[model samples]
Target: MTFRTLLMASTAAALLAPAAQADVNIYSYRQPELIQPMLDAFTQETGIRTNIAFLNKGLVERLQAEGDRSPADIILTTDISRLSAAVAAGVTQPVDSAVLEENIPAAFRDPGDQWFGLTTRARIVYASKDRVDPAEVTTYEDLTDPKWQGRICTRSGTHPYNLALVAAVIHHHGEEAAKTWLEGVKANLARKPQGNDRAQVKAIWAGECDISLGNTYYMGKMLEDEEQQDWANAVNVLFPEFQNGGTHVNVSGIAMTRAAPNRDDALQLMEFLASPRAQALYAEVNHEYPVSPTTEASDLVQSWGTFTPDDVNLMDLAALRGTALRLVEEVDFDG
Candidate 1:
């Protein structure tokens, strides 16, 4: 069957899967199908009814408008910026869960207890196996080499993927260096940024560019893809100079609403999401690395090999949003 068909079928099962239970309600920015399985599994094990309101946009505003009457128990989103936006908007609360703290690594979770990550995805380089030698391409810093000029492809700078990456640079090297890196990268793009992560891979295959930066899971999707698996097959996954520590890691995380009607159930869901059992599902089914230290990668993820993730604190990356955005504008990165 087609991927659209598969996505549709998965979404149906997830939405109806939890209708029978009645204890928890979630206002999620995640698509219904992507996160519903965890909810269904959580409900089956604990009998907590989960009601999810899935929206790709406007969740923060919706929560704010609802205020005290909000039926939201938890908020789920796919990036540090989105989760941080929720916390900054006062829509989330400081959760006091030792179980959660222990399950997720300190590097992945919010220091203030406002948000907890469930899964992580590495933002690494995909170099043309034939064109770029593995040893010479060490860290993200190497991307600036004039030898590889006019051979990079990326999605729009406005994209969250690049924004978070920019934030990461700011975290590791400071704003000035980050700005320089951004300018260097922009100068090297083979074409103006336009498509998603997968498209960058496709460009490499078409000989449009020799390198791209994309999440690890997109590699899995491409290989599994019937029409476009070659998008992934065209290049090799390289974690870039992690010997300094590791590549930069980011997460798709969740938080509890300050006025959650089902606090206990929300807490249970958070705890369950971080459990090894639930975490394995993320890697196996969706291709994201589990944030839980206890969870082993599925065979698919294990095939990608492991590397040390950058030790930069997640909070600092989240706090750099404004500086990152301003730099993006200053560089005319979108153009």
Candidate 2:
């Protein structure tokens, strides 16, 4: 079926489903399958049915367009900027859940309780096991050193993942310093910034570059894919700090919709997600770090040596997105 048709169908189903069903309608950027396991567990535990309408783009616009009629109770998405964008668009409401406050770290959630982060993936270095020494690249700042010139690979600077990292740089150091770091990293690019995180690892395997920046979970993902296992084995996941801070990280988060029809159920699901069981379940499903301090990452994820996550509140990094993009453009990072 066409996407619009499916969206309308999901919306209609949500609108028509009996309230007695005790269901929570979710509009998620996360694929349904990726989260279905946890949703199933929620249903098994609380008897609350979960319905999700997955959308790749225009999530904020769709919620805004639907206005008070939006059937969405929760917004499930990745990245701090997208979460902040929904808040900025007036589409999400502040949730005052004590459970959420206690479960998620303050740095991972909105200070106003507008959104709660579920999982975090660090932006880290993937170095050639054969060519690069683990101790050589220990911090984000070291990637720009002259010794590593023409030895890095990355995707587009304009992508949200990279932008978030750049935003973190702006948070730690000043703007000029962040820009110069961007420039230096750009100068050191093996080719131009031109592929996804996995591709960068493949580049490293092919001897295209010695090291690249990628989220920590990509290592697990690569290892699971038979074709990519070789690529995965070629590199060691290295968590890089911000010189003055810890490793830069980003989150996949959820928030309540302003016009939630099932507010109580939504809050129930939200609270359930913050529980230790759900936190670990979700983290294991995605091969990521759980945001709840009480929960530990899956064994596969923990095998990747741990590092401190940056202390800056993600909302602070979200605020710097505009400046980060402008800096990327000014540096002609791709040029």
Of the candidates shown, which would achieve the greatest lDDT relative to the real structure?
Answer: 2
lDDT of 2: 0.91
- The count of backbone overlaps in candidate 1 is 6
lDDT of 2 by residue, 193-262 (tens): 8879999999999999999989988888899899999999999999999889999999999999999999
lDDT tens digits, residues 1-335, model 1? 97546654554245435434446777777777778788788878887778776766898998898897777788889888899899999999999998988898887888899999988889989888778777767788888778777999988887777788888878777889888988888888899998889988888999999999899888887878798876777688888753345687788998999888778878998898888888988677778988887788788878878888888777787788788988988988768
TM-score of each: 0.90, 0.94
- How much does candidate 2 score in TM-score? 0.94
After TM-score superposition, the amount by which residue 222's alpha carbon in candidate 2 deviates from its true location, in angstroms, is: 1.2
The TM-score obtained by model 1 is: 0.90
Q: Which ten residues in a row have the lowest lDDT in candidate 1?
A: 11-20
